[model samples]
Target: MTDDLDTPVLDNHLHLDPRHGRGVDAVKDFVRLGGTHLLVVNKPSWHLGVEPDEPTDFRPVFEETLDAVAAANEVLPGRAWPVLGVHPGLISRLVDDRGFSPEDARDLMQGGIEVASEFVADGDALALKSGRPHYDVSDAVWAASNAVTRRAFELGAALDCAVQLHTEASEDLTDLAAAAEEVGLDPTRVVKHYAEGRLAGLTPSVMSEKDRLERAAESGEPFLMETDYVDDPEKPGMVLGPKTVPRRVRWLLEAGYDDAVRRAHVETPRAVYEIDTESTLNRDT
Candidate 1:
């Protein structure tokens, strides 16, 4: 997938689980495909074989993600940013399997978000990843999850960074935007991961499939693209492949959607994450 252009190609949401998956090699796959940058989000704690009994246990998980970013930067320096946080799905596991009360689980997850915020504060990460469960959940569990999500928004506001959300799919994000506003976070700074379409108002890091990318480009609206590459060995490329973003960008460029590709890959990331992806990716080229 190598191309002549030095245009920035970023995958907004991705994971590299070394112990259980391809890890940095998967990152190499992306780099080989012309991907210039990645937002390497941490996997679920359980995926790392960590059953956290407390908040600090998440430190190793976050550290692993940071290490992966560091390694990836060695391949393409200044190309990957760490987005660390406790996965919202942990709430269900705590409440269902561990038999913790919903309130207690909320507190635990909030504490995990707090721990993640520390990494952001120290400049080890660029943003946070959080959201409520995407599957059917009890009312109390849902309430607690929302509380935890709010805490993530609050932390993001304090850190002056973005929060990438993994929630139930929907074209409209009115309630999600309101939650960010209520927590004093800019709604525009909240990135809806795995988004299927233009969210009513909030930013969407749409998964980088050809059709979806085409539609987003056709709309002429501000948005980002991603592979959401889980890097799981069993269900490899669960959401999309590591090479999907760059491969699709090549197709888009050939299709004469140059302006839209630039807007999505460089401009939108700069606007949302405050990172100059254009300069960052083009340097040394």
Candidate 2:
């Protein structure tokens, strides 16, 4: 049903990894399903062996992400953008498997921040990504993770791009906003990715869960929605498919929450991530 709709929506977070063989099909399918824009993140590297050197060494992954954006634009110009950073889970893996000392890990993370900034500065990325206090990590690793996350926020301040945070669902985000402010980044620029509840006083990029989606819509709070679609063939549509957000919007529209759908699909994304929805959708048409 969403495939026939013309309403503009942005899937603010998704991974279009070639490793998974989704490639352009993923991007095309998303566009066909009424997704007018996307923010493609670097593929998580925890599955790869530990990266022990400077973030510049991660150039290939960042390049791949850019390539995905390029490919999407080729299919539908201005349809996609990139978000670059070292995944927080990869940080924990490096500490556990590679025996990277805390200081060394911090150094590596700083390198990542530098790399992310370069991409944003070059207009190749719209934001930086990182997470603090990843629950899967040990306390020591979590400390290192938070340090890296803070550095990312600092970079966001300098570069004037948003920072997408991968964090535990429903966690309090006041401290995160405070950290952003401390680093001179506007708290509104810090987006909590994969959020599942009402993140009072913070912005969230939410996923598709009917009850949670309903709750967020009813709250009349400003927020964005995402599928977090992994694009893995092994677990096809694992979190959600490309069409999920559009279908949700359809529900919102029918439920008399048209303004909520617009806020979530258009206004929040434009304000938080700087997407030009009008231009993107116009190009598609």
> Considering summed lDDT, which 10 consecutive residues are worst modelled in model 2?
45-54
Give the poorly placed runs of model 2, Cα more than 4 Å off. Answer: 47-52, 283-285
Per-residue alpha-carbon lDDT of candidate 1 for residues 48-117, written as tens digits (9 for 90 to 100): 8888888899999999999888888877633899999989899888988999999999998899889999
lDDT of each: 0.87, 0.78
lDDT score, candidate 1: 0.87
After superposition on all CA atoms, how large is the RMSD of candidate 2? 2.0
Candidate 1: clashing pairs of residues: none
RMSD of each: 1.5, 2.0
> Candidate 2 at 82: error in angstroms?
0.3
lDDT of 2 by residue, 1-285 (tens): 226444677777888876555878877777666667788888775433336477777777788788888887776534788998888776665677778887688778778778878989998789998886547667777778788888998899988899999886664789888988999998887898898647854687878777778887887887888888887788788678877876777777888888887888778887887776766676434
Quote the positional error of residue 156 for candidate 1 in Å.
0.9
Best by lDDT: 1
